[model samples]
Structures are given as C-alpha cells and as structure tokens.
Target chain A: MHWEIVVGLEVHTQLSTRSKIFSGSSTVFGAAPNTQASAVDIALPGVLPVLNRSAVERAVQLGLAIGGNISRRSVFARKNYFYPDLPKGYQISQMDHPVVEGGSLTIQVGPDEKTVRITRAHLEEDAGKSMHGDFHGMTGIDLNRAGTPLLEIVSEPDLRGAAEAVAYAKTLHGLVVWLGICDGNMQEGSFRCDANVSVRPLGSGVLGTRCEIKNLNSFRFLERAIEYEARRQIEINEEGGTIRQETRLYDPDRDETRTMRSKEDAYDYRYFHDPDLSPLVISEDWIARTRAAMPELPGAMRERLVAQYAISAYDAAALTASRATAAYFEQLVAASSGEAKLSANWMMGDLFAALNRYELDMAHCPVSAAQLGRLIVRIVDGTLSGKLAKEVFEALWQAAGEVDAIIEARGLKQVSDSGAIAAIVDQILAANPAQVADYRAGKEKMLGYLVGQAMKAMKGRANPQQLNEILLQKLN
Target chain B: MSLTLLDVKRVARLAHIAVSEDEAAIYQQQINGVFDLIAQMQAVDTTGVVPMAHAQDLNQRLRDDIVTEPDLHEKFQSIAPQVAEGLYLVPQVIE
Candidate 1:
C-alpha cells in the first residue's frame, strides 16, 4: 500500500534579546559556564522574575508580521519535569493560553507553494546545557543558556514531504530573522526544530503513531530525519508491528534516529499557572504601536520587488530570502538609479558567492553597495564591458577601492568604438579565412567561432554584441 | 473506565518505567483512574474550538548577529572534571 508521510515541526527560536526572558542576565552565548546566570535563572530563593519588556515587544512584532491573533490575556505555566539541566525543576512555559495563535506561513518547495498553518507560538524559558563529554565520568551543566527566552512555534501536520518541511522551516527562519526577533542561526542553537513524523497507509482515515525527532538544528538534518523516521515507521507497520510513539534524537553522523524517551502527554506535565507572575495583558495601543513599527516582511517585500522592479520571481525570492540581502539589493538599486535587475543579479550571483567564500554576513560585506552601483553604472553607460565589470568588481571587493579608480588602473574599458571593433574584426577575418568563407556560405555556427577569436584578439575588452555585429559585417 | 492489560504495559513503556507483571494489575487500576478524568475532556464540544498550544500570540525574540567575545579557552575548561591542554579529557575506550 502507498504510504502518506505526515510531518509537523516544533521550532524553538531563541529570542534576540539583550537579557534573559525573566531575568536581567545577559543572553549572550559562549559566556563562562555560570557567569551569566542570575538569581532567577538559578532559581535562587525568593527571587522573582521580571518579564523583559523588550522581549514581549519583540514577540508582539513577530505576531504582527505573521498575521497571528494577539492574545489579550495569556498566562505562563510551570511545566513540571525532572531534569538536571533544568535549574528550576520545572520549565516556565505557556500551557492553557499561548501568546500567538492561528498564523500561517507560505513556503515555496520546488515548483509549488505550500502553506503550513502555525498552531501557536509561545514564550518560554530555555533550559541550561549539559555537557556530557566535558568530564571523565560525569557531566557538567552550563547555565549560560539557561533562562534565555525561546519562542516555540508549533505547526500543524500540513506538511506532506521532506522538501515541504525544510521549506517551511527555512521560511520560518527567514521570517524570525527579518522581524528582528531571532538570529536564526542554526549552528549556535539560536534556531532549532523538533519534527513530528508519522506514516499512514494511503486512504486511511486514522492517523498513525508518531515519533517526535528532536535537536534538528539544520534544514538538511530536518529533512533527513523526517524521511528516515517516516520510512522506519512504515516498515514497522507493514511488518505486522505497531509503531511506538516516542521522542527520538537524530544522530547526524550515523544518519539515523534512536529512541530518546517515551513521549509525554499533556497530563504528564501536570501544568499549572505560574503563581509568581500575573496574567500577561497586552493592550490595543501596544499592538498598534508594534504594528506601526513593523518593517516590510518577506512576502510583501518579494511582491514589491517583483512588481516594481519587474524581476523574476526566483530573483525576487532570492533577494528577499534574508533581511540583509534584501537591504543590500535595495540599496544597490537605489544607488544605481533603480537598475533593479542588474542590482539583483550582482547581489545574488557575484556578491553572494564572495560572501559564501568568506563566510561573511551581508552586513559586514566587503563590497559596498555604492561601489557595486558604480560598477553597474559603468556597464550601463558602456564605460566598462560586462567582462571588465567582473574584473573591476573583484578588485574593488579585495581592496575596497573606488570602481572608477579600479577601472582606470586596470585599463579595462569596453571597446565600443565602431572603428576600433571593426579593425579587430578585420584582423580576425584575415587570420580565419576558412571560417569567414564558411560563415558567408550560411554556416551560421561559424559566427560564434569568429566572435570568440575577435573577443580574444581585443583582449576580451570588446563588447560581445558590437563585436558580433562587426564580425558578421566583415564576414559577409 | 478500565484499562486492559495491553494498555497498562503501553503506558508504562511510554513513560519509561519498568512495570512488572505483579504491578501491572495495580497500574491498570491507577491508569483507569487517570483516563476517567481525561475522558471528561472529550465531553466538551471541541469541534470548532481550536486546541490551544500557548497562552498569547507572541513570537520568538532574536539577538543581534554580533560576536560579543572571543573564544574563552581556560575559563570554560575550569569547570570540567578533567582537562589536558585546551581539550577536555575523556576516558580512552579503544586504547
């Protein structure tokens, strides 16, 4: 029987706040093991947690960006659990009422767009880290990440495949980063996903047992984990065995999932409203102010770029994939007098390659938008050939010099003068008599060869279009 | 509400508890008590009412993408049980 894979993701994004959610401890990662732990973070006796207003505001901004229902009143609850990493013995999370509800994110997977419905995004405190291999025979706890605010975004089981799941996760990552709510860095554990995967026979009405895969910090791992777990469950069911609903951990090196523990139902947590803090009350004015402060989200910006700039959907999506990339493209376009397509190409192709090679963010990009704009202007004005522009771009990227200065220093100007190009074409035709004869005999393929020789003879400075026309004229 | 023998073992295994045959009868009674309370949740008309995962409509807060400090070598290693040079010491299994 054909099997259908059902996937839902629970993404935990660490909020980009200066301090911990309920304490004033610095939310910086890689700090000393216990230095950043505040009184409330360690659950010191009689210490109270004061919710950071900035964290709340960040959450409100995210709700507005995602078109979620902003709750008028929400309550934090103590999720009772026993773990060494949890300093409070119970994690303070939303139980009965969460902060955000009923939002949807649209992600493009392959050639189709899929909308994954978000069940809720709730505010919760992160647990401390337990380093198991740090000691000879024991583990050590690092409280640096403890008490860090996390927004757990839960999605409905609308995803049907691994590609859709990855697309959904990536889209969420981009949205969080664009809203300035999270850093969306998977390596630093700023953004993590727990995927719930199950397999049911096609046309089956009832859902199958699911195993929740945890600690998938990368998009590749999320897709792989879901694919592996879904196949495993289907195999088990086909072999006349029942699927065990449990929590599993993905081992990236081995590329398989092992059972971590049995999944806990809601009643197992014994969730109750946290008594120390009052019910969170967000006002209309607060929502309005946050909404007013919202920047253009990815979807809106993508539409605007496509409509206003007449760029392709792929280019627009690539430009708007990240906030910094979008900002760089917009700045390049603005500086180049609204040459949007050229700006998009440079940013997506050349600029992106350099950034990836250097492992640098767009904010710290070595090539400034102004320098890139000048190079584009030179290309548009025929001062520099397309080939010469690439050379200029590299020089300016390496030394942070002006585009015009680089162009002048290298003497890499487009040979657009008809007389100069015509002379080069004449020399090429004289050297390649047989090719010229073939071209005149209607062997159209020979034109490309002559054009290549002409370009090479001109030292790659001649514009291909002008060289092609001049070469064809001389050939005919 | 009563739990069959199979339900008792499933719940025990799901919770990662070791339940023996003698204790299975007692757990069966205890789980039935818990299930009786949960059965009340089914009585409420939830056909249209959305199941709530959190209390408020808040998203995750993010941090600035700035490197605040260099890698701390000795300070982070100080809390480890064993350390050699800059690496944490672990028992050698193969050797």
Candidate 2:
C-alpha cells in the first residue's frame, strides 16, 4: 500500500538582540556562568519581568516580512515545567495569543515551487543550559542564555517529503538572516528545528501517529531524521503494531533516532497569562516605520536579478542565495558597467572556488570587486585572452594590484593583431605537413589541433577566436 | 474541581515522579479539581478565535554577524569534574 509522509516544522530562532528579552542583561553567548544573568533572568524574588522594546519590534518586522497578521495586542504566558536548566521552573512563552499569525513561505523543492503555510510565529524566552559533565556528579546551571528571546515559527503540516522539509528550512534560514532578525547560525544553536513527521495511507483521511524529532539544527540532519522516522513508523504499522506518538531525539553519530519520551510524559505546561508584564500593543506608526526600513528580500532580489541581467533563473537563484553573495555580485556588476552575466559566472564559479579553497567568506574576500571587474572588462574588450585573464586574476587576488598593471607586468597582452596571429599559424602548418594534408582530405577536425598548437607556442596570449580565423584562412 | 486517578498518573509521569498507588488516588482528586476550573475555558466560543501563543507583539532582535568573544578553553574546563590540559575527561567505555 502506498503511503504519504506528512511533516511539520517548529523552528526556534534566537532573536539577534543585544540583551535578553525581558531583562537588560547581555544576550551574548559564551559568557561566564551566570554572568549575563540579571534578577529577572534568574527569576529572583520580587523581580518583575520587563519586556524589551527592541525584541518586540524585531518580531513585528519578521511578521511583516512573512506577510503575517501582526496582532495589535499580545500577551505572554508562563509555561510551567521543571528542569535543571530552567531557573524559573517555568518558561515565559506565547500560549493563547502570539504576536503573528497566518503566514506562508514559498520554498522551491526539486523542479517545483510550493508554499508551506506557517501556523504562527510566537515570542518566548529561552531556558538556561545544564552542564551535566561538570561539577563532580552534580549538574551546574549556566544562566547566560536564560531569558534570551526566541521566535518560535510553527508551520502547518503541508510538507509532503523530506526534500520539501529541507527546502522549507533553508528558505526560512535565509529569510531570517536577510531580515536581520536572526543570525540563523545552526552551529551556535541560534536557529534550530523540531520536526513532526507521520505517515498516512494513500487516499485515506485519518492521520497516523506522529513522532516529534527535537532540536535538529542542521539541514542535512533534518532531512535524514525525517526519512528515518517515516520508514520506521511505516515498518511498525506493517508489523501489526501501532505507532506511538512520542518525542524522539536524533543521534547524528548513529544516524538514527531514539525515543526521548512517550506522549504520556508530555508536559501539560499549565499555561497562563503573565501578570507582571503589560500587553504588547503595536502601533500603526511603528509598523509603517519598520516596513519602510525593510531591505529587498531574497525572492524579490532573485526576480530582479533574472529580469535586469538577462541571466538564467538558476544562476540568479544561486547568486542571491545569501545576502553577502548577492551583494558581491551586485558590486562586481556595478564596477564592470553592468556586465551582469559575466559577474554572475565569476561569482558562482571562480569566486566561489576561491572562497572554498581558502575557507573564507565573501565579506572577507581578498580581491576587490573593482579589480575583478577590470579583469572581466579586459577579457571582453580583447585586451587579454581568456587564458591570460585567469593568470591576471590570480595575481590581482594575491596582491591588491591593478588588473592592467598585472597584465602589463607579465607582458601577457592577447595577440589580437591578424598579421601576428597569421604568421604563427603559417609556422604551425609548415611544421605539420601530414596534418595539412589530412585537413585538405575532408578531415576538417584536425584544424582545431593546429590552432591549439599555435596558441600554445604564443604562450596562451593568442586570442582563440582570432587564431581560429587566421588558421582557417591559412588552411582553406 | 476534582482530579482523576488517570490525571494524577499522567502528570506524575510527566513530572518524572514515581507515585505510589495511594498517592495516585489522592492526587487524582487534586488534579480533577484543577481540570474542573480549566473547563471554564471551553465555555467561551473560541471557534474562529486564533490560539494565542505569546503576550507581546515583539519581534526577534538580531545581532551583527561578528564573533564577539575569544575561544575560552581554560575557563570552560574550570567547572569540569575532571580536566587535563584544557580537555574534559570522561570514563573509558570502549577500552
């Protein structure tokens, strides 16, 4: 029997704020144990939580970006739970009223594009960390990350497969980073995902038991975990056993998942409105101001790049995958008098290779856009051959020197002069009499070999197109 | 409001507590009492009303993409149960 996999994702993005959501304590990670904690963070006696205005504004901005309905008034709820890491014994989260609702994100999976409907994006405070390996048989708590603001974006069960889930996650990661709302750094635990996956028989309406995979931070892990869980559940159902709805943890080392707890072990989280903080009321003026400050998002930028530069959709999408890469492409294009297609090629191919070789980011690239632009222009205008241009690029990248200066210093000008190229072609034909005879006897493909030898003798300075023209004239 | 024996067992398990049979029956009544009060929420029509998740209409705050701190090796090891040359020590498993 055919079965369909249903998946939903709950993504928690750590708000890129300077301080904790409710307190003025620094939200910086890796601080000494409890050093960044304030009275509100640790939930000290008589300490009331004060909402951070910046955190609220950042959520509003994200809601606007995702086309979500920003509620004018929202409330915080205290979710009761007991854990060693949770200093307050309860996490302050959205329960009944979230800040944003009913938005959709479009993710491209395979050759088709699909929109994954987002249920809601809520605000919450993160719990502290427990150091289980520390303190001689006793776990210690670090409140540095406690009360850090998090935007929990939940999606409806619209994804059909593991690929779609991964695409949706990547799109969300890019959007959050582009909106300046979250760094989307999975390694730092700033952005993480909890995926709920279940399978239903094809043409059946009833949903099967769903298992939630918790805290999968990497895209590769999200895909692998969902695939593994779906197959595991299907096998269980086929073996005359009912699948249990439970929370599981993904073990990347083992490449499998283990049951963390059963559904009965789930926390009721006795949620209620927090009394200390006031209702979050958003003003129309604030919305308007935030909207005005919004930058061009990835989708809009990709469309613009495709239309304005006459580049393929694939190239445009690859170029605009990240804000830094898109910015670099734009700078190169601008410097090269709008040679957009060439700029795209260099960025997606040569520039990307260089970055990977040195393990460097585009922002820290040693070669400037203007210098790369000069090299591209030289190749286009026939000042340097394609082969010589590559050498010039390497030299300019190593030392921030002028492209023209490097070309001149190496005496690598292309032999675009017809008379000079024809002389070299004549010498190659004279040396290879058998090749000449073969070319005359309808073996026309041999003409290419003669041109290659001529160019090689010219030390790759001979323009291939000019050499081809001169060689053909000499042969025919 | 009264708590049920089932509610007591479920909540105790969630709370990671091992309840005795006698304690389970006693806490059942306590949980039912809480549920009866919570049943008041069902009286209001929430059909079209969206479920609330948070109180504040706040967005997430973002930071600049810059590393702010140097790598802390010695300090991180200070709290470890056992440490040798900046590395945490754990009991041998394979050998």
Candidate 3:
C-alpha cells in the first residue's frame, strides 16, 4: 500500500523589535545569563505588561505581506502550564482570536506551485532558556529570552511531503525577512519550525494522527526530522501499531524524533482571558500605514527582476533571495549602464564565490557595490578581458584600489590592438607550421592550440576574441 | 458539564494543588454555581446579542518599542528559591 505524508508547520519567529513584547527589557540575544531580564519580564508581582508598539507593527507587516486579514481587536489569554523556562505559571498568549486571521503563501515545489494556507498568526511572549545538566544536579534557567516578542504562525495541513514543507518554510522565511519582522537566523533561534507530520494510506480522506517534532532549526533538520517521523509512522502502520498523537523532540545528533511527552502528561492548558491588559485594537489607518511602509516583497521583487532584466527565474530568485543582494545587484546593474544579465551572472558567480570564501555576509561584504560595478563596467567597456577581470576582482577583494588602478598596477588590461596582437599571432603560426598544416588538413582543434600559444606569447594580456580573429587572419 | 469527584481530583492534580475530599466537594459546589450562572446566561433568548469578551469597549494602549529597563537579574535571582552561577536552578527539566 502506498503511504502519503501529511505535514503542517507552526513557525515561531522572534520579532526584530528592540524591546521585550510587554516590558521595557532588552530583547538582545547572547546577553549574560539574565542581564536583559527586567522585573516585568521575570513576572514580578504588580508588574503589568504594556504591549510593544514595534512588535505589533512587525506583526502587521507580516499580515500585510501575506495578504492576511488583520483583526481590529485581539485579546491576550493566559495559557496555564508549569515549566521552569516559563517564569509565569501561565504564559500570556492569544487564543481563539489572533491578530492575523487567515492568509496563504505560495511555494515552488519542483515545477509546480503549492499554496499553504496559514491558519492564524498570534502574538505571544517567549519563555526563558532552560539549560539542563549545566550544574551537578539541577537545571539552569536564563530569563534573558523571557518576554521576547514572538509571532507564532500556524499553517493548515496543506503540505504533502518534506520537500513541500521545506519550500514553504523557506518561502515563509524569505517573506518574513523581506518584511523585516524576523531576522531569519535559524542558528540563533530567531526562526524555528515545529513540523507536525503523519502518514496515511493513499487516497485516504480521513487524516491520520500526527506527532509534532519540535524545534527543527535549520532547513536540513526540518526535512530530516519530518522524513524520519514519516518513516517511523509508516513502519508502525505496517506493523499494525497505532500512531500516538504526542509532542516529540528532534535529536539532530541521533537524526530521530523521540517522544518528549505523551498523552498521559498532556496538560489541559486552562486558557482564560487575562484581566491585566485590554483588547489590542488596530485601526484601518494603522494597517494602511504599515502596508505602505513595507518594502517590495520577495515574490513581487523576483518577478520584477526576471521581467525587467529578461533573466531566468533561477537567476532572478538567486538575486532577490535577500533584499541586500537585490539592492546590490540593482546598484551594480545601474552603474553598468543597464547590463543586468552580465551583472546577475557576476553576482551569482564571482560575488557569491568571494563571499563564501571570506565567510562574510552579503550586507557587510568588503567589495562595495559601487566598486564591483566599476569592475564590471571595465569588463563591459572592453578594458579588461574576462580572465583579467577575475584577477582584478581578486585584487578588489584584497583592497587593491579602484578597478582602473588595479588594472594599471597589475598591468592586467586586455591588449585589443589589432597590429600588436597580429604580430604575435604571426610568430605563433610560423613557429607551428606543422600544426598549421594539420589545421588546414582538417585538424580544426589545432586552431585553439595556435591561439593559446599566441595568448601565452602575449602573457595572457591579449583580448581572446581579438587574438582568435588575428590568428585566423594570419593562418589563412 | 456534570460535576464529578474524579474530575475535581484531576483538575487539582493538574494545577498542582492538594485537595481533600471535603474541600473538593465544597469547591465542586462553587464551580457548579458559576456553571449554573453561565447556563442561565446561555439560555437567554437574545440570539442577536453579540458576546462581549470584556466589560468595557476599551482598546489596549500601545507602548513605544524602546529599551528602557535596566538589568535587574541580580535583584530577581536573589529572591529565587535556588540560584547558582547567575542561573535560577530548578529540578532538572527533562525534554
């Protein structure tokens, strides 16, 4: 029997707000154990929550970006649970009524596009960090992360497999980063996904029970966890064991999902509307302001890049993956006098290679867009051959001055002088008379060898096309 | 919902509260009182009345997103039941 995988994702994205969601505490990551934890963040008595404006605005930006309905009013409910990380016995979260009601994001799965319907996006406060076994016999709790703003985006079970889940995740990640709500840093736990995976008999209308694998940080881990969980469920079904609905944790080291808590320990999170805060109301004008303030979304921007530059969708996707990269390409192409295709090639080729080598972010790359644009301009204007242009690019990376300066310093300028190159070509043809005869006798590959010799004679400074043209003239 | 001794015991256990049988019986009565009131409200024939979540129609006030809180980890952790190495120690949290 064929088994079909059903998947849905609950993504918890930490907003890029400067302050905690309810308190004035710093939301900075990697601070000391509890240095950023304020009184209200730590749940001090009589300390009340005041919603952060930026967190709401960031959530509104996400809603607008996804074309979701932003609720005019949303309420905060206390989700009661007892965990060491959560200082408050009950976490302040939204239930039943969320800020963002419904939306869908389209993802490219193979050659087809699938749209994942977003159930809702609710604003909530993050719990603190609980470090286990840091001491002799106790767990260490760091409240620095407590009260940090989170927008928990729940998706409908629309995904079919691990690939679609990942595509949806990456698309959501790109959109959130494009909206500037979340930093999209998986390593720092800024963006993490909880994938609920299940497998059922093919064409089964009834949905099977799913086990949620928590905290799949990276795209690879998310895919691996879902695959492992799906396989485990399939084996159980084959062996006639019923799948349990439980919360599981993905152990990346073991590459498996283990049951964290079973149905027996399931806490009835007694949710009640908190009397501490009032309803969060947003006006239509506020939504309009946020929508107007948002930058061009990634999907629209990618389409524009493809249409305007006539580049392939793949190239356009690579260029518009990040706003900074797209901005850099735009500047470079603009400076190169509308050389968009060449600029796109250089960006994905040379710029990506250099960034990978240096392990630098595209935002803080050493080679400025203006500087790289100048280099491409030089190549476009026929001053530097593609080979010499690469050499110049390396020099540019190493802080070797401007493009023209590097060209002058390294003497890497292309020799396009017809007379000068023809003499060198003549010398090569006369020296390789036997090979030239072979070329005439239909060993057409010999032409490449003759041109290579002429280029070598000119110390690789000869323009390749000019050398090829002059070589053909001299041989004939 | 019907009141039951076992349901009361389960709720007390989930909330980590010790409930004697006598106290459970008393609390169950009180819970039934609230449920009765809710039932009475639900029985009203005002089908068009929209349910209100709060008493007043006031919206939540927004606070500017600024980092104004100073470090008070020392003060907060000082009052914790257990503290070690700038961390609030608790019974080991599994999973």
Candidate 4:
C-alpha cells in the first residue's frame, strides 16, 4: 500500500518593527539578557499593553500583498499556559479572529504550480529565550525577545509532500521579506516554522492523525524533518501500529524526531478574549493607504518579467525569487540596452554561479549589475566570444577592472577581423594535414578537431562562428 | 451549578498548586457562592445584548514604532530572585 504525506506549516515571522508588539521595548536581537524587557514586557503590576500601530500596518500590508482579507474586528485572546519563559503565564494571541485571513500563495515545485491555502496570519507577541546550556547547571532566561511582534501565518494541509512544503515555505519567506514585514533571517530566528505532518493511504480522502513538529528553524531542516517524520509514520503503520497524535521536537544532530508531549499532557488552554485589549477595528481607508504604499509583489513581478522580457516562465520565476534579485536583473537588462534574453541567461547562469561560489546573496554580490551587464553586452555585441567572456568574468570576480578596460588590458578581444581569422584557419589546415584530410574524407566530426586547433593557434581570440566558417571553407 | 470539593481539588492540581483537604473544602464553598451569583445572571434572557470583552469598549491605543526603553537589566534583575551575569537564573528547565 502506498502512503501519502500531508503537511501544513505554521510560520512565525518576527515583524521588523523597532519596538515590541504590546510594549515599547526595543526588539533588537543580541541585546543583553532582560535589558530590552520593559516593565510591560516583564508583566509589572501596573503596566499595560499598548498595541503598536506599525505592527498592525505591517500585517495589513502583508494581507494586501497576498490579497488576504483584512479583518475589521479582530480580537486578541489570552492563551493560558504554564511556561517559565512566558513572564505573564499567558500568551495574548488570536483564537477565533486574526488580522489577515484567507490568503493563498502559489509555489512552483518542478513543473507543478500549487497554491497553498493560508488559513490566517495572526499578530501575536513572542516569548523570551531560555538558554539551557549557558550556565553550568541552571537555565538562563533572556527576556530580550519577549513581547516581540510575530505574525503567525497558518496554512491548510494542502501540501502533499516534503518538497511541496519546502516550496511553499520558501515562497512565503520571499513574500515576507519582499513586503518588508519581516527580515526573513532564518539563522537569527526571525523566521520559524512548525509543521503538522501526517501520513495516510494513497488516494484516500480521510485524513490521518498528525503530530506537530516544532521549531524547524532552517529550510534544510524543515525538509529533512518532514521526510523523516513521514517515514516514521509510514513504518509504524506498516508494522500494524497506530500513529500517536502528539507534539514532537526535531533533533538536527540526531537527524530524528523525539516525542515532546502527547495528548495526555496537552494543555487545555482556557482561551478567553483578553479584556485588557479592545477589539481591533480596521477601516477601508487604512487598507487603501497600506495598499497604496505596497511594493510590487514577487508574483506580479514574475508575470511582468515574462511579458516584458519574453523569457520562459522558469527563467522568470528564478529571476523574481527575491525582490533584490529581480531588481538587479532589471538593472542588468537596462545596462545591456534591453537585451533581456542575454541578460537573463547571464544573470541566472554565470553570475548566479559566481555569487554561490563566494557564498553571497544578490544583495551583497561583489560585482555590480552594471559591471556584469557590461561584460555580457560585449558578448552580445561580438566583442568577445562566450569562452573568452567567462575568462573575463573570472577576472572581474577578482576585482579586475571594467569589462572594456579588461578586454583592452588582456588583448582578449574577439579576432573578428576576417583576414586575421582566415590566416589562423589556413595555418591550422597546413599544420594539421591528417585532421584536414580526415575533415575532407567524410569524417564530419574532424571539423571539430580542426576548429579546436584553429582556436588554440589564435590564443582563443578567434570569433568561434567566423573561425568555423573560415575553417570549413579552407578545408573544403 | 456549584463547584464541589472534588472539582476544587482537581482545579488546584491543574494549576500545580498544593491545596490541603480543608483548604479545598473552603475554596469550594467560596467558589460555589460565586457560581450561584453567576447562575442568577445566566437566568436572565438578555439575548440581544452583544457579548462584551471589556467594560470600557475603548479601542486599543496605538503606540508609535519607536524604542523608548533603555537597558535596565540590573534594576530589573535586582527584583528577580536569581541572577548571573545578565541572564536571570532559573532552575534547570529541560526542553
């Protein structure tokens, strides 16, 4: 029997607000422990939570970006639980109503484009960190992250496998960063993912009982944890055992998940609307104002890239994976005088490879778009062949001068002069008689060897197209 | 409509607080008296009245996005029971 995996992700994105959601505490990471925790954050007796307008505006902006419905009357509810990191013993969150509701994100996994249904994106405060290994025998509590604003985006279990889950997560991450709501930094815990994973018989409509996996901080770990959990469930079902619905923790070091808590230990949080907070009411003017300030979403940019540049959907998707990358690509095309196809190819191919080699993102790429675009322009303008262009690109990667200057300095310009290329081809024919004879005696592949010799004799400055034409004419 | 001693004991256990039998009995009596008042209120129809979350019905005051708090770890940790370096020390919390 074939088993199918079902996954739904709850992504917690820390909003890039300067202060906490409910308090005026600084939200800067790496602050001294408890230093950023204001009186309201530490739950002082008299301090009250005042909602930050920027957090709400950021949430509204995200809702507009994804075409989600902004709730006019969302209420904050207190989730009662016992945890040391929670200073107030209750987390104020949304239970029934959330700020943003019913958005869908479309992700591309290979040839398939799947739209994952976003259930809700609710605004909530984050708990502080409990550092266990910091001290010799005791735990250390850092309240710096307490009361930080987080938008928990919940998705329906529309993803069918681990790869689809990863695709959805990445698309969501890009959207958050593009909208400027969140920094989308996975390393510093700005973006967190919790996956509810379950496995059921293939082609069955009945859903299987799922276990929630918590705190998958990285995309790589998210993929690996889902796959491992799916396998574990399927193996248990194969052994005639029942899958226990529980919460589990993914141990990246062990490459497995351990049971954190079960239904027996699950907290029955007595959820009640927080009396201290009034129900939030959003007006149409607010939505309109936020929408006016919104940047172009990645999906819209991808469509424009396809229509404007006449590139493939795959290439357009790759180009608009991030807002910065898409902007860089546009600048490159502009620098190349609207050579969109060549710009797309170079940006996605050699430039991307170079960025990866240096472990850099498009935002911090050492080479400027104009610099790379100039190099690509030379290739398209017949100043350099593809082979010699790569050599120049490598030199540019090492802080060599501009494309034109580098070409001049190294004398690496394409030997496009007809007389010069013809002389080189003639020399190749006279020097390699056996290969030239083979080229004339119906061994059509021998023309490739003759071309190689002509290219070598010209020190790779020969225009490959002109060299091939001249070499064939001389041989025949 | 009223809480029994057994219910009171169960609630105390859920809260992780120790309650003696005598204390449970007294708590039950006190809670049951409150429940009787709630039962009287529940008897009224009041069906058209919208449920209210707070008495004031005031909108949440919005704060400007600014960092107004300075680092007060020493003063804050002074009130805490345990502190080391800058972190608040606590009994070992696994997971």
List candidate 2 segments past 4 Å from native: B4-95
lDDT of 2 by residue, A224-249 (tens): 99999999988987787898889999
CA lDDT, candidate 3, residue A384:
92
TM-score of chain B of each: 0.54, 0.56, 0.82, 0.88
- Flag regions of model 1 displaced more than 4 Å: A134-136, A263-267, A431-435, A438-445, B1-95
Reference contacts reproduced by model 3: 0.85
True contacts kept of each: 0.02, 0.01, 0.85, 0.79
Error of 4 at A160 (Å): 1.0
Task: Report the candidate with higher lDDT, 2 versus 4.
Answer: 4
What's the lDDT of the predicted structure labeled candidate 4?
0.90
lDDT of 2 at A52: 74
In DockQ terms, which candidate is top? 3
Give a tens-digit lDDT track for model 2, residues B1-95. 56557767877876679999998987777767677878897778888887653455543333332223343435544565665423334443120
Score candidate 1 by lDDT.
Answer: 0.82
| Candidate 4, pairs of clashing residues | none
lDDT of 1 by residue, B5-81 (tens): 99889767645589999899988888888888889987888887864434544432333332233334456556656
Q: Global lDDT of each model?
A: 0.82, 0.82, 0.90, 0.90
The TM-score measured for candidate 2 stands at 0.87
Model 3 residue A259 CA deviation in Å: 0.8
TM-scores for all candidates? 0.82, 0.87, 0.96, 0.97
